[model samples]
Target: MKIQKSFAQSVGTLYLVPTPIGNLEDMTFRAVKTLQTVDLIASEDTRNTQKLLNHFEVKVPQKSLHEHNYNERIPELLDFLRDGKSIAQVSDAGMPSISDPGHELVVACIEADIPVVALPGATAGMTALIASGLLPQPFYFYGFLQRKKSSQKKELEDLRNQTATLIFYESPHRVKETLKNVAEVFGNREVVICRELTKLYEEYLRGTAEELIEYLSEHSLKGECCLLVSGATEIAEEEVFEGTLKEQVEALISEGQTSKEAIKSVAKRHNLKKQDVYKEYHEL
Candidate 1:
C-alpha cells in the first residue's frame, strides 16, 4: 500500500532578517511582512527585538537564537520544520548570518533540505565598506581582531601583503590601538573610519595611517567603528626576473644557505607567498 503525504504540513523558511543598525527607519518593507507572518521569530536578544516588533506591532512569537545557542537550538528548529511549521531567523541587528551567529544554522537548514530565504536588510559591514572609499572589490572582512596586541600584530603581519581591501569592526576603546597596529603592519595605507553610522552624530574620518593615529589621539570617539584599509599592490612580473632567482639562490646557497634558507630569503624580500617560492625551487 502507498502512503499519501499531507499537504497541511508546514514548511519553515529561515529568513536572515536584518534589523536597524542605528536608525529604525532603515528597516525594509518586506522585512516587516516576513516578521509579522512567520510562525516563530528567532533573535539574538529578546529585549532588543521586542522593541523592534513592538514598534512595528508584529504580534508573532519569538525564540532566542544567538552565537551561544545557535548550534544547540538548530536540531529543535529543524524538528519544528519537519512538523510543518514556518519560522523566521533573525539576528539582533544587521543580517542574521554575517558577523553574526546564524551561519551554522543556515548550513544545517540546507543539509536538512529546508527552504531558506534571506530578506534584504541593513548590514553595517556593507554599508561601511561601500562608503569607505576603498577599492570595494577583492576585499576581506576580519570582523573583529584579536584584542591582545601581540596576537593582533600577528594577524596584521599575515595580511601585510594581502592585495585587497581589509575591514574590521571595533569598539570605541580599542579603535586607537587597532589603527596603530594597522599603521605599523601595513605602513601608511589609506583608511576610512566610520562611526555611529546612520545616526545623528554619524561621522566618517578619512586619512592615512599616520594621520589617523594623530587624529584619534586628540578626539573623543563615541561609537563602534568600522575600518577599511587598502591592500598592497601586486608588483609587475618584470620586477622579479630583474634579479635572477638562480643568481640569488646560488649566492645564498654558496654562503651555506640550504635550499629552504635560500627560498625563505627571496620570498620575504619580494613579498611573495612562501609556498610559491618553494614550488619554484622544487621545479628547479
Candidate 2:
C-alpha cells in the first residue's frame, strides 16, 4: 500500500482539475490557481480549454490527452511527472475520468507512486440530480447508454428492479428515443429532464416518462441532457413473477396452458399486454 502526502513528495503531482460545465463563474479559485501553477495542462480538447484558459488569464502550455490519444500520452505525462514537473489533467468540462479520460492516467500514477490531487468542481450528473427533485441519496449515476436500441433495452431490463434513483447522461439527438425506451421498460414513472445546465438556457422539465415523451415529440431539445428517473417502487404481490416474461410464458405452456392462455397469464402477471408478451416470446 502506497501513501500519498500530496506536497511532501519531490516527484511531480498529477492534479485532476474540474472545468466548468457551462457557466464560466462555476470555475473554482483553487482550480484556476492549480492550472496557473502547473507546468503543463493536459486537456481533452485544447481548443475548448484554450478559451477557458484565456478567460482565466492562465497562459500555461497545454497538451492533448483525449480518448484516442490517452494510451499513447500516459507514458509521456508520467515522464514529465518523474522529472519533478507537476501536471494538470482537465476534460472539456466537469471532472475528468467521469465518463471521460483521466482514469487510466490516475491508475498509472498510483502504480508508479506518483501523487494525484483532485479538486472539487462542477459535475453535470450531480448538478442535475440535486435539482431534479428526486431522492438525492442512493442514486445510481449511469453516464450515457448504449446507442443501439436493442442493447439499451436489455440494459434497462436489468436495471428495472433497482431501488436507487437512476441518473443518466444523454445527448439531445437521442434523448427522445431513450425516454421512449425507459417508458416501455420501466413503465411511465416520474422523470426529470435537465438540459443546458448552469447556462442561460438551463431548464428542468419534470413529468412522467410517457408525458415527457409526448412533450419531446412537440418540442425539439438542444445541448446535453440529464435524465433522472424515480426508482422501482415495491412490486405488488400478484405482479411479481418467478422468471422473465418469456420464460414464464413457456413454463405456463408446459403446464398444459394454451399459447394464448400462457401469453395472457404472463402479461397479467407482469402488467404487460398479451400481444407484447406473445411477440417477445416468439422473438418477433
Candidate 3:
C-alpha cells in the first residue's frame, strides 16, 4: 500500500484541482488558492481555463494537457515535480480526471512516489445524482457512453443487471437517442435528465425513458446532460420463463403456448411494450 502524506515533505506535490462545472461561484477557496500558488497549471484547455483564472484573479502560467498531448506532456510535468516545483492540473470543468484529462498524470505521479493532492469541488455527475431524487448511494457513475449506436447499446445491455442507480454524462445532441436505447434495453425505467447544472438555466426532466424521448422529440435541449436511471428491480423466475427474451418466448411456444401468448408473456415479464417485444421476437 502506498501512503501519501501530501504536505509532509518538500518534494513537488501534484495537486488535482476541481474546477466549477458551470457556475463560477462553485469554485472552492482551496481550489482557487491552489491555482494561485502552484508553480505551473496544466490545463485541458488553456484558453478556457484562462477565463476562469481571470475571473478568480488567478494569474498562474498554464500549459495545455488535453487528450492529444497528455502522453508527451506527462514526462515534462513529472520532471518539474522532480525539481521540487509544485504543479496543479485542471480540466475545462469539474474534477480533472473524472471523464477528463489528468488520470495519466496522477498515475505517473503515484508511480514515481510523488505526493498527489486532490481538492474536493464541483462534479457534474454527483451534483445531478443528488438532486435527481434517485437513490444517491449505491449508484454507478459511468462517465460517458460510447458515441456509436451499436456500441452504446452493447454497453447498456451489459449494465442491464446492475441494481445500483446509474449515472451517465451525455451530450445534448445524443441524449434523445441514448434515452431511446435505455428504454429499449432497460425497459421504460424511470430516468432523470439533468442539464446545465448550477447555471441559471439548470433544469431537471424526470420521467420514464419513453416519456423523455417524446418530450425531447418536441423540445430542443442545449448544454451538457446527466442521465440518472433507477436501478433494476427484482425479477421473478416465473415472470422471465427461461433464457433470453427470444429464448424464453420460444421455450413457452414449444410448451404449447401460442406465439402471441409467448410474446405477451415475455413483454410483461420484462416490463416492455407488446409491440417492442413482438419486434424483437421477430427481429423486425
lDDT of 1 by residue, 1-284 (tens): 32323233246566678899999999999989888988898888988899999999999988898878877788988898767777878777788877777888878877777777777879888899898888998898888899999999989988887888998988888998999999887888899889998999999999898898899889879888888898887532333444566567667888999988888898877878768877776664
- lDDT order of candidates, top first: 2, 3, 1
Compared with the true structure, what per-residue lDDT tens digits does model 3 show for residues 91-140? 99999889998899999999999999999999999999989998998999
Note the residue pairs that clash in candidate 3: none
The lDDT leader among the candidates is 2
Better of 1 and 3 by lDDT: 3
| Candidate 1 C-alpha RMSD relative to the actual structure | 6.4
Give lDDT tens digits, candidate 2, residues 139-201.
Answer: 999898999999999899878988889999999999999999999989999999999999999
Clashes in predicted model 1: 1
Supply candidate 3's per-residue lDDT for 208.
Answer: 90
Model 2 compared with the native: what TM-score? 0.84
Which stretches of candidate 1 lie above 4 Å from their native place? 1-10, 234-284
Model 3 bad stretches (over 4 Å): 235-284
The Cα local distance difference test for each model comes to: 0.83, 0.93, 0.92
Q: TM-score for all predictions?
A: 0.79, 0.84, 0.83
Candidate 3 at residue 206, lDDT? 94
